[model samples]
Target: MNEQLVLRVLGMDCAACEQRLAYAVRRVEGVRYAVADHGTGVLEVHLMPGTDREAVAARVVEAGFTVTGVETR
Candidate 1:
């Protein structure tokens, strides 16, 4: 099974921040796909089954973005 996660991000000031976050998420194992939008401060990620959402979020934070909220679908 696959799961989708969307995170509402904060403190992203420009496109570069968006790019960095996207890259970090993509680096996680089992991350099938990912996209980060600076305008919306949202990141949509598709993951394989059992993917750790918090770990993914941590990577985002480590990349220098604050995760304000998260939704899994």
Candidate 2:
């Protein structure tokens, strides 16, 4: 089983910030893939089933970004 999570991230002001956040999300245990877009402020993540959304949010926070919203697709 797998889940797709698209998060709208705020406070990313540069390409480095986007890359860092994408890298952080990928570092999460259940995340299979991640793409952080600075222009759109969105992070699309493909994750394993039973993954904790809070954990995902925490990883983004650890990278100094804020998750404003989450959407499933």
| Model 2 alpha-carbon drift over 4 Å, by segment | none
Q: Which residue pairs in model 2 clash with each other? A: none
**Candidate 1, which segments miss by more than 4 Å at Cα?**
none
- Residue 7 displacement in candidate 1 (angstroms): 0.2
Q: Choose the strongest candidate by lDDT.
A: 1
Encode model 1's per-residue lDDT on 5-67: one tens digit a residue. 999999777888878888889999999999998899999999999988888999988887789
lDDT of 1 at 40: 90
lDDT of 2: 0.90
What is the TM-score (0 to 1) of candidate 2? 0.91
CA RMSD of each candidate after superposition: 0.9, 1.0
